[model samples]
Target: MTSGLDARIRLSRGPVELEVALTAEAGEIIGILGPNGGGKTTTILALAGVLPLEDGHVAVAGGEWEHAGARRLAPEQRSVGLMLADPLLFPHLTALDNVAYGPRSRGSHRTTARERARTELASVGLTEHLGSRPRQLSSGQAARVALARALATDPDLLLLDEPLAALDPETRARTRSDLAARLAPYEGVTVLVTHDPLDALTLADRLVFIEDGRVTQVGTPTEVLREPRTPYVATVVGLNLYAAQSDSSGTLTLVGGARLVTADSTAGSVWATVSPHSVVLHRERPEGSARNAWPMRVSDVTLQGQSARVSLTGPLDLIAEVTLASVASLTVHVGTDLWASVKATEVFTYPR
Candidate 1:
């Protein structure tokens, strides 16, 4: 693929240090996913030339921005557009002038900049609100205006740091759709840093997971969802995960000494994942051929949409999801003793 963005950077600020490498093709949207302080925003700032790298390089659209500990361009010198969680629009400017600011700063004449802003605003469905001030617009409207302002610059790269985070649930959903539509036709590399799974899954072509200042996984949304390599990703994807050592004899010993028999086996450290739906809870020893069963005590129970997620602690900590009907029929509750079982085939094991 033709390179749109290529970067390998390392930065240190007192106690925190970040190192990351990333690449994207033109027209690709790469979602940056990570826990708090995992360097997601640091990566974005480095790419935008706002944060200087202690080492490494950054190249965008085949042009060098930073190389070998030297910055070739400032944040404004690079052809980049950035939008943060807060719109940060000039409160004194009308929507039209705010959108026009980028082009105007880039040397466009007054009339030309205003025309470009009008077209961009129209593209984001903000044509009717061009005269509206930031205070006069709703959360969703302001977000669209922010997007239009970003695109009006005709940037070669776009950086979005949790762009929809400030909106309410309903407004976020609507604005997300609007943002996706606007990004569809832009032939530029886009890096979106987001904590919301829905936004990343729906809008990004690929997902890059970072943790502890390092990249842990990179794949399509479907690929990451099907097999998460880290505990954080597994939790985000709603799966119970365990780190264990496996033996050739098909016995897997978890970190805490819990043993589970699996259908597949190999030596060395491995990660085991089990879907919450696959767990079976019983009041007593079940009369079945399941290979893995343990007496567990319910620690917590919470309703998630239509199902209840039951947290259990015993030989192995686990999460189980059951329908409300099952909850009522089994009389499940906190402090209840139950046996949890999983078929050997249900436990998926992969090398760490």
Candidate 2:
């Protein structure tokens, strides 16, 4: 059967410190994704009992591991499986032997442990490659064997640390698919830490965006993409957003009282966002179709790799993304007069 986890962590070293609270359930994958040095790996390590917490507690499967004042349990006592980036298979051992290593060390009879390892390997489709040594198997096959080895312990909580990071893109994709299929049968709390957004979006039920040692936002895939609370989350969500105020009657005002209508039913304070590609620029304010048009002067034009981003000074400062062909055809240049138009429907409005 699956289980749940409740944790509050505080970790410190030298001048750096971190505090976070997390709750998760079995058969669910909680993806922790962020840029490098964001403390995601540390958080996973702490939960796995590899790193000591300065304060707080961790509980899984109704079994408490630590508490604020007194109680504590050592790492080995916790029924958890942790797999790091490297498979770290013993060079001298075959794939089957490597998987059997964990259970054997835990006191299972050699015959019984090897039987368990064979079952695990067959489940992950690595049974055919059991006799192959780590160096003899392909990278993808090695990854599957590593995953089977982790599962051999029958852990309550599974901790995966960028497990697919070491593979080539093609192998990574296939192995990822294999992993998703295997994890579906596991009825235990699972935590996957990765920097790849594709992996998080595809495999995890919920995504937590962390930075500077704290969680900025956590939500389902769609929720995180639609509503982001911080600038970092905004960038992570692929949005350029700004804080602004709005009055009733569905009319919103920008920083300088530049008025625009909204599709959202909200008032008082709000956030206004428009996609760069949604903006349509013309030589002068033209009528029809588009609802919001503002007088603007080109401030700067930058090529964003293949596409271009043009900055404008107008009723409200805006950035418009256009293709290279459009940049040349519009005769766009710094100081050129243009009218920026964006529909109210395309402008997303949300409470701040």
Residues 289-314, model 2: lDDT tens digits: 88889899999999977888898887
TM-scores of all candidate predictions against the true structure = 0.93, 0.82
Q: What is the lDDT of residue 219 in candidate 1?
A: 95
Worst 10 residues of 2 by lDDT: 231-240
Model 2, global lDDT: 0.84
Clash tally, candidates in order:
0, 0
Which residue runs does candidate 1 get wrong by more than 4 Å?
A: 265-268, 328-334
Clashing residue pairs found in predicted model 1: none
Among all candidates shown, the one with the greatest TM-score: 1
Q: Which tens-of-lDDT digit does each residue in 6-55 have in candidate 1?
A: 88989975555888999999999999999998899889988888888889
lDDT of each: 0.91, 0.84
